[model samples]
Target: MSDHAVSGVPGGPVRESRDVADLMRWFGDAWVLPLLVGGTSLVIGILLIVWPNVTVTAVAVLFGVYLLIYGVFRLIESFAADEAGGTARVLLALLGVLSIVVGVLCLRNILQTVVLLALLLGLFWLVGGIIQVVAAILQRSRPHRGLTMVSGVLAVLAGVVVLSYPGISLLVLTVFLGIWLVVYGVLMILGAFRLRAAGRRSVEVTGGAAAAPAG
Candidate 1:
């Protein structure tokens, strides 16, 4: 059984063709989700960095919330992307699930040890980054593929750094994570603009198709 999810206009027929821009048209903005994801990430990243007297428990809670929010968005993107291949969708879905699970674990403080928390966050970023890279690669036709790939690579590096020095102090870890988030958030914002451009192209294609004479 295939796990493919088709895209289309809300309250309308599902389109088998990946080229259909129903969502883009009906939603009045194809790039909305990306913008939301980027915007939120950027905000949270900034908060984590500049906030005074940030404690371990606060960091854990904030990080957990970010994870849950990001996971939900990723899951939505995975299923709603008709243009994405099944494998890509699956990878994204897995990332979402992993993120959510990690978020829950963080919030619940299931692992009381500081080391364990570091390990968990590191693993999440590591796996999620790899999945993003792979999915970006597989999505050959997507706009801003390079941007996405860059984002993934940054994530992977951040993860590696965290894992390599799991014993790092709160100040060091907080600053590092903040820096990564800011950069990644900027890239995602750029990617969202690129997606907007793609949406415009989709509109043109759809218009041309509609204008074609019937056989």
Candidate 2:
């Protein structure tokens, strides 16, 4: 029996299938949005790096803006993953909320925000480094495993330095944050292109299936 017949209701299965296909298409096409966000992030990071002498208030405002944009983008991406369902969606939503809240707080009080942001940055780097290191170990057969391990080590050391010197001047913190942001933005842009390619492949597959003759 065909999927439509298995659904046991006229037009139900076909409609549902079409809906899912449409959602996938939408998700794939939406990759451009993330690319734009990443590009903006790169610009901000560059600005921070170039003008490291900017005031604390300026840096705080910039960070808040970046966080707000990041949070909103994350929420959109999470919602788009509706098919994932359950725990994954909930966790993504929670992360989005946390980012938004932290962003708002940063905007409200620049001085306090600096310290909190420093701590958060350090923790993020530390956790990310550990994950990278673990991933490198697991994928030892990969050609670039050595480079990945080295990157991970550097990330861990950077995290430690940030945490150990949390009281560092705002200029120094900005420089560190700027460098990380630039790297992250480049990764995001690369991911966007990948998504775009995947979307095209999905469309091609769906088209082929639709054109195929029924037995």
Candidate 3:
């Protein structure tokens, strides 16, 4: 059965197509569940930030749990999805095993874990920035050079700060992350509300149409 139907709005005979486009845009329809899982992880991440000491171990444990579950799911999905060929199945299975191993390692090493994750992140950003700079140089004809340059500069600056003061980077990184989380959380909440409003309007319009006198 089709998931959506085209029905006229309350105001007119115009056919309103019910589009799952938003869902598709945010995440391919098949990836909706994973997105939800990821969103939940984001919330958990925020909680971990709020109580870092208390949460460090929990966070590590959660990651391990999440990764293991995700890997298993991917492995299973690979088998079910027709588009996933032999190579894909093998990759998914490997990923599943790797995830489980990583999770176990994280749990075991959670005690010795340093707060230098930010520095590692900074290094990643630096590498990414450098790559972008190179790409921009190579693609001088592109109109996005300015934006790319800005991103590269920002990433390099962030990297430098984290690397120069790994000791102080923890607090700074946590604050920066908290700010981002707030922004993202607000946006997601707003989006959920908007989706709910649209759903309500759709239901009302459908209800109204059914109540209309037959002409």
Highest-scoring model, lDDT: 1
Candidate 3 segments whose C-alpha is farther than 4 A from its true place = 1-36, 52-55, 115-215
| lDDT, candidate 1, 1-215, per-residue tens | 22222223533323423235565564337577778778877887898889835777777887788789879988987887667889999988998999899989889957666677788888888889999999999988888789989988888888898899978777777777677777877887888888888878777777666555444
Best prediction by TM-score = 1
Cα RMSD of all models vs. native, in order, equals 7.0, 5.5, 11.1
Query: Candidate 3, residues 1-215: lDDT per residue as tens digits?
Result: 22222234433333331233333233223333434444654675576567554443554555456556545654654464333345544544554555566556546654343364554445544654565455445444333345445555665676676677666533455555444333333443443444345445555666565456545
TM-score, predicted candidate 1 vs. hidden true structure: 0.84
- Give the better candidate number (1 or 2) by TM-score: 1
Off by over 4 Å in 2: 1-18, 110-117, 120-160
For all predicted structures, in order, the TM-scores are: 0.84, 0.74, 0.40
**Whole-model Cα lDDT of every candidate shown, in order:** 0.78, 0.69, 0.48
Better of 2 and 3 by TM-score: 2
Tell me the lDDT of candidate 3: 0.48
What does candidate 2's lDDT look like per residue over 1-215, in tens digits? 77647665755655555665786688678888878877977988999999998877687678678778877876785576554454545545655565677667667764555577677657655755665566556543333345545655766877898999878778889998788778767766776777787777777787566555455
Q: Superpose all Cα atoms of candidate 3 onto the true structure and report the RMSD in Å to 1 decimal.
A: 11.1
